[model samples]
Target: MAAKAALPPHSPGIATGAGWARLRPRGGGAMRGYRYEALDGARALAAQVVLVSHGLGMAFFPVHSPGAAAAEWFGRLAVMVFFSLSGFVIATSLSRLVASDGSRFGVPYAVHRIARIWPPLVLAILVTFAVGWLGQNGLPLLTKTGDAYRLDAVAFLRGITLTFAPGDATFVIDRALWSLRQEVYLYAIAALAALAFAGRGARRVLAGGAVVGLVILTADRFFYLQSLALFAAGAAAAHFGGRERLRALARAPWLGPATLCLLGAPLLFVVRPGFIDAMSDGAGFLAYQAALGIPVALCLLGLAIGDGPAARAAARWSWAAAFSYTLYVIHVPVMTLVFSLRAHLDLAPGLAGTVATLLLALLGAEAVSCAAALVVERPALFRRILFRLLAATGLARPAVQAAPSI
Candidate 1:
C-alpha cells in the first residue's frame, strides 16, 4: 500500500501539457471539500498486524491442531483487514491521482502500482522455489502430500504466473498469493474506472456497481466476491468519506472502539463447537466472510480519519508498514523452514514449543523481509550497481543527471 498523508491541503488541478489536468475534484463534490494527509503509518501498522497474526497461525497454531482454532480465527480476521485495507489504499491513491492529474494519471498510476507490487512478488516466487526444493530434498519442512515439493516445471510456471483458477489443485503453492491475485483484479478494475470515468460521481457509481455486480454474480464464490465487495467499500469511502456527515462519524469517539469490537467478536466463536463446521458448510463460509467484511470496512474508515492514540502510535512506526508486504509474502516459506527444523529438533508440543517456534519463525521472517526490502523492494542500490556494470561493459553511457532517487 502506498503511504502518504491521509489528508493533505487541497489544490486546484494542474494541466500537464496533455489534454487532462491533475485530478482535482470537480464542482462541489464531497471529496473536493475534504483535505488529506499521509496515512502511511496507519496503513503499515495494520498490514504488520495481519502479518503477525498469519505468522502466529502458521507457526504456533495450525488450525488442524488442538487449541489452535483461535489463532486460525485471528488469521482469518487479519486477512479480512488486509483485503479491506488494500481496497482503501488503492482507492485513496487513485482518487488522489485523479484529483491531481485527471486522465493523465493513468500511466503514472499503473507504473506506481507495478513498481509497488511486482518486485516483492518476483522475490517471493524465487523464495518459494528455494523452500520447495529444500523440502523435496529430505527437508521435513512441509507435510507429505502428493503435490508437496513435487517440482513440476509446469506447476512452478503456474505459481509465478498466478494463473490457477480458484479451485485448482495447483493453487496451494504459497497460499497467501491467492489474495494477491484478487488484488491484481481490483487494480485492473480501478484502472478501468480511471480510464472510463471522467468525474468523481461517475467513478463512485462504477465502484457501487462493482459491489452490486460481484454480489449478484459471484457471491457464492466467497473468496472472489467478498474481496471485490471490500474493494468497492474502500472505493466508496474514498469517494464519499470526506462528506461532513461521514467525517463527523469518523471522528466520533465510539466509532473506533465499536469497529474494534465488531472485528473481534467473531473470534469468540472460534472456541465454540460447530463454529468452524458451520463455516465450512456450503454458502455458510461465504456468508461469514461477507459479514466479516462489514466491520473490516468500518475499521478502514475509522483509521482513515481517526486520530486516536492507537492510530497515532501506528503512524509512528511507518517503517514497519514499509516492510509489511515483504513480511507477508515471505512469511509462509519462512514458516515452512521453521517447521522443518522443529521436526528434527523434537520440540515439545505444548506452549513452550509453540512459543519457541513462534519466536523463531517471527525472527526468520523479519530477517528475510528486511533483506528483501533492501535488495528488491528498494532497488535503487541494485539499479546503481547495474548502471555501473552496464557502463563498464560499454553498453551504456552515464547521463549528466544522476539517476533520480526513488
Candidate 2:
C-alpha cells in the first residue's frame, strides 16, 4: 500500500509541471519521465462515481427518489475530478512533449487523441442507437410510427459534433456526453495553455497560474473552460513539484483534508431539495459550476498527499484507469438497459437493488470497455493523427504530443 501511494517514477513522454528542467542524457540521448500508474488508478475511481450516479438515477425513479437525489448530488463530484485530472494529465503530457520536441507534436498526437477518445465514444453511440432500435420494437425514434424520431439523425449529429448549438434535447449517446462536449473544449484550452507555458522558469509558472485563475473567473458559462483550469493546476503541480514534495506534504496531511472540506463547501448551499428548488434555475446552475472547480482542486490535492491505505488502494487499481474514459462513455446507456431489465423482472428497486445494480453495471462497463480499449482504441496511429490535426487547427497546442500508450 505504501509503495502504491508513493508517486510513480517519472518518465519521458508524460506531461510535466515544471518548465525549468531540460532533458539530459549520459549517452547523449535525452531522458524523459514515464507514465505514472497511480494517477490512472485515481481516474478509475472517478469513473466509478459517475457510474454510481447514473445507477442511482435508474434505481431512484422506481424506489425512494429522495435518497437517490442526495447520492447524485454527492456522487456527481466525479465530474470535477474528471475535469481536474484531465487538465493535470494533459498538461503533464504536453509539458513532456515540449521538453522532447515541440515540433514533433504533429501527426502522432492526433492518433493518440483519436485512439484514446473516439473508439469507445463511437461504440457507445452504436449501443445507444442499437438499444433504442431494439426497445422501440421497429418504430422509429422509439415512438409510434407517426411520432418524432427518438434518436433521430439530427440528435445524433448534434451529439457527435457536441456543438450543442441547436438547443435541442440534451440526450444522445448518453446524457453524460454533455461532459464530453465540455471535454473537447477543455482539450483546446489545455493545448493553448501548454503553448503559453512551454518556456522555462518563473514566468511559466506565473503564466500558468494566471491562465488558471482567468479561466476560473471567466469560464462560468462554459464548463469546458473550468476543466481547462483544473487541468492547468494539475500540470502546474507536476511540472513544479516532485515526489519529494508530495511525500513531505503527506507527512503533514492537513492540506488534503482541508481541500476536501473546501470542495464540499459549496454543496451545502444547494444539495437540499429546498435549496435546489428554492434557487432560480440560473442560480442553481451557477452553484453547480462553482462546485466543479473547488472540488477538483481539492481532489487533486488529496491524491497527492493522502498516501494512506485508501489512496494506496486507488493506486493499485490504477491499471484499470485506461478504461475510465470508455467506461464513462458507455456506462449510462448500459445502466439504462440494466435498470430496464430490473423493471421487467419486477425486482425490488430498494437500496439493495440500487447498490447491487450499480456494482454490476460498473463491472459490466469495465469488462466491455477493456475489450474496446484492447480492440478499437489501442491503435496508436489513429490517435496521433487526431492530436496533430487538433493542434494544427489551433484547437489545442502544437507542442502537446500524444502518448502511444494512451
Highest lDDT model number: 1
lDDT of each: 0.59, 0.55
lDDT of 2 at 244: 52
Q: What does candidate 2's lDDT look like per residue over 1-406, in tens digits?
A: 0011112345553333343234221222112342355566777777777777666655554223455545555555676667666665665555555556553442444455556666666777777666666556732231112223356777666655665332332263266776776666566556545545455456456557766775676565545444555555555544443445443553445755666676566456553555333322455554555445544544454454456665677689787665667777777766666666666675757878777876776677668878876765454565566666777887765545433343
Local error of candidate 1 at residue 179 (angstroms): 1.2
Q: State the displacement of the C-alpha of residue 36, model 2, in Å, after optimal TM-score superposition.
A: 1.9
Q: Scored by Cα lDDT, where does model 1 land?
A: 0.59
RMSD of 1: 6.3
lDDT (tens digit, per residue) of candidate 1 on 305-360: 66667556655775565577777776777776786778767775877887888888
Candidate 1 colliding pairs, count: 23
lDDT of 1 at 330: 69
